[model samples]
Target: MLYLSQVLGLVTLALWLYCVFDVITTPDTLCRNLPKIGWVLIVLLFPLIGSIAWLVAGRPERTQAVTRPSAFPEYDRPGRFAATSPDDDEEFLRRCRERAEEQRRNAPGKPQDES
Candidate 1:
């Protein structure tokens, strides 16, 4: 009986601590019902009841999977061309070949055999 009570007390303390920490850490914008400071005070003042209240009313609503914006915004723009492979881009390969040929022609050195 005494052991059971001890266990229940520990559980309550854990719940209270968790609620307090959660209230403190939760962003003001994300907190529901009451403001962040209000939630924190509530949790701190009434351990069991406040913890339950925070869980039921003050916690932020769980959102479905959030689609974050891409780190490279330019690549995510609509109508942007995205090539799967450089080798598959014929226009890009042709430009590279033209640039290489121009560089070879303008080389300032003894002309080697063009094999």
Candidate 2:
């Protein structure tokens, strides 16, 4: 019974300390119900109940995390291989050849004979 009480006391102390630090570190805007300083005072004055109150009422509500788009979006998928080199891509080669042919046909040096 004595050991259990001691353990409980330690737990309560840890909770109190955690609440105090958490309140101190938390941003002023995020704190709810009361101001950040008020929450800190509550936790310091009333150990167990204050800590519980801080957790329940003063702590900021969790928002869904926003994932930023990656610069290399191609590699973001699971179970995927890296993209093939441009030289190995048939479509890329075909496009390059078509572009070259179009440029050749439109060459400025070529004389156009008008009918």
Candidate 3:
């Protein structure tokens, strides 16, 4: 019985140590919003409750692969024109519209223009 208790204690200690090491060495990206050292103290000082806290609060969130740029990606990047809008210039858009119409006329299945 005493041997069994000793073995159980050793197992618990090993689990505690592993949790400590894992939390401490985990990178910020893998651990979400906590410092590794902070995890160490929590797991060390309060074992059961702290480990539970780490499980619930410190686990990493999975990020999805971003396949394309967002429709409004320009808002966050650093640039001189970050606050400006191309739509503010009407003349620039008039030329663009003319070019689009020209391309559409040249595309397949388009009827030829008649004077």
Best candidate (score: TM-score): 1
**Cα RMSD (angstroms) for every candidate in the order listed:** 4.1, 8.3, 10.4
Clashing pairs in 1: none
Worst 10 residues of 1 by lDDT: 60-69
- Residues 25-107 of candidate 3 have per-residue lDDT tens digits of 66655674577777778899987677767767875544633245669877657763643466987877899999998999899
Q: What is the per-residue lDDT of model 2 for residues 1-115, given as tens digits with 9 covering 90 to 100?
A: 5798899999999989999999998888889999998998999999999999999998988772334689988788898876789999999899999999888878899976566
Ranking by lDDT: 2, 1, 3
**Candidate 3, number of clashes:** 0
TM-score of each: 0.71, 0.54, 0.41
Per-residue lDDT, model 2, residue 4, is 88
User: Against the correct fold, how does model 2 do in TM-score?
Assistant: 0.54
Itemize residue pairs with steric clashes in candidate 3.
Answer: none
Off by over 4 Å in 2: 64-115
Model 2, global lDDT: 0.88
* lDDT values, one for every candidate: 0.87, 0.88, 0.73
